[model samples]
Target: MHHRGFDDSCGLECVENGHDSNKFSLLCSGSAVTYASFSSQNESKAKLASSAAPDSGATKGGSATKIAWEDTFEVAMQRARTEKKPIMIDFYTDWCGVCKQMDADVFPKKDVITESDKWVSIKINAEKRPDVAGAYGVTGYPTIVFAEGTGKPLSVIPGYSPSTEFVGLMREARAKWKPEAAA
Candidate 1:
């Protein structure tokens, strides 16, 4: 889903007191909107979202090649530090239908995958890693933060973009990157 706006406070007001709680809101801008609650008859989106990371087993346009997302946030940072590359952090939730759509349509696009190589890509499950999401001030699902290797955000894609648009977005992030900015 596209984000109306990000909260200055990092937009994490909806995080539940407990990790296991199924109920939580996705606060965006000034509006507090909740994701649809899963009912008994419906297949549980919460279960799917909570099951695994989005990048796991993901391939590029049904090809054998895989998009290289670092296994963990710590690892991605380490790679970025060494590689002197920026970071592309995809902040998403399991129950978010739009997030899944991007995973299927956008991320796997040849251009997106190719463009992604220039950055250290990481996928952080917002529900699973609320701390990280809060730190980034993410107010919506599929908030893609483009940051310096040192983890300073320079730009953000707050919602879904198609393959063509996403590729350009990636380039824009790379262009905005300053190697010495973090120094």
Candidate 2:
């Protein structure tokens, strides 16, 4: 199968030739947006590779955020339990434009990254993890579910949320597990 992508900046796009267990990606202008096959198993490494790119965004003190997203639900749940934080699971699909947009625009922003620290962040390919997605009752692309450390969902952001709005949502969802908020 052949996939096509349209970026407002770069109209030239491809979703990768055919499909493979491994993903295919292209770096537009060396640092713009990444056009690739997004999968849970490899996106972590992709994050590492992209961290050094020009548009990768930086945290406070200029440290590059590297590999912060958990690749799977099970790992994210474990981290949520260990850190005593809520879980933010991003259920996305390869063909979802909003999902790719969020990956390129929202998830890498400094504010979103900072707010994400309050929860255990994860990226789940809904097509790859239909069981998990179905269990969460996710019927849309880019269904971001904020759940307790125990994995009970508290709230959801069902579609594309820009960085500014996304940060607020993250703050609200994360607050659910806070001691003061819980009390």
Instruction: Please report the candidate that would top TM-score against the real structure.
Output: 1
Between which residue pairs do clashes occur in model 2? Answer: none
lDDT of 1 by residue, 1-183 (tens): 232323344333343324325434455554543342223212333433444336575432224255687768998887888878899999888766657767766777777877887888889898888998899998787789999989999897776566787888889889999976543
The alpha-carbon deviation from the true structure for residue 65 of candidate 2, after best TM-score superposition, in angstroms, is 2.6
Candidate 1 positional error at 83, Å: 0.8
Query: What does candidate 2's lDDT look like per residue over 31-104, in tens digits?
Result: 32233334642453344344322222223222346326776688778777776778888887765554666777
lDDT of each: 0.69, 0.64
Runs in model 2 deviating more than 4 A are: 1-67, 178-183
Give candidate 1 regions above 4 Å deviation: 1-53, 58-64, 181-183
Please report the TM-score between candidate 1 and the true structure. 0.68
